[model samples]
Target: METAYIETPLGIASISGDEDGITSVSVTKESSEKPSTKIPVILQDGALQLQEYFQGNRTDFDLKLNPAGTDFQKKVWDELLNIPFGKTTTYLDMAKRLGDPKCIRAAASANGKNPLWIIVPCHRVIGSDGSLTGYAGGLWRKKWLLDHENPVKQQSLF
Candidate 1:
């Protein structure tokens, strides 16, 4: 797999992929990354889309994802893509929807392993009581993403 790093508001996002499609989009613990020049041909469009997303011009992504995981993990990740922009869902709801409430832990585990980060929308997942939960990218970044997606517009009083 080929890898390239891009600087984002949250941190450095390491995007990996090839002709088979994107395999991963991860936020590194590092706070900064050098600016990109020419991206790989296969991953170029995905890079552009991500930049647009951060600019608030995109509510959803349109990139081909090829996250590598087990079948169960793939199922969980697929469901995550269904989560709308600016909306949130609980792990219990996801587990119930998958038709196996008992697999809640497994589901959560799969979510934790999601390699496609923002592109896969794993940040939309939360605790059952509407609280932020474990995020591979960190909870602060999760909150920032949610807030970025659904910012509260202040009304002006003239």
Candidate 2:
């Protein structure tokens, strides 16, 4: 029922929720205006958690989420949560996990509609060919998030 904005590496993320639980989180282009009011008491923690996530100081989110969506979309988003940090999965893979071997398109659609953003980790979804694909926040941001989570550490050349 309330919303707050937090500056992040990708952009300014708009977080919305209530005392019951978090309902939505979406990113936007950079903004200069400050929040009209303080982030609601119920949502301040969630906002801070998101800040930590973008800072690479946190990987797993531990707050409650209440994203609004259809039953099928909820199912797909739940499956997306199973994708671990620093990992990726394909849409076809998600479809199979949803117990429908042919629902790849539907699964992809749900993935695209995920409103929880980083909390639900929809950016982890990719094409079956190991290619980075569609992302509502822009593919560049997706690539940035993936790289942040799975930085390629240099190895010794012995």
Residue-wise lDDT of candidate 1 within 14-94, one digit each (tens)? 888999899999888765566567688888888888889999989888887888899999999999999999888999999
Question: For each candidate, what TM-score against the reference?
Answer: 0.93, 0.91
User: Which whole-number lDDT from 0 to 100 does residue 47 have in model 2?
Assistant: 91
Q: Each model's number of backbone clashes? A: 0, 0
* Candidate 1 lDDT score at position 60: 87
How high is the CA lDDT of each candidate model? 0.88, 0.88
- Clash pairs detected, candidate 2: none
Error of 1 at 22 (Å): 0.2
lDDT of candidate 2 over 1-158, digit per residue (tens): 98898777777788899977999988865577454367788899899898888878898899988888999999999999999999999999899999997999999999999999899999999999989999999999899888888957557899
- Model 2 scores a C-alpha lDDT of 0.88
Ten contiguous residues minimizing lDDT sum, candidate 2:
28-37
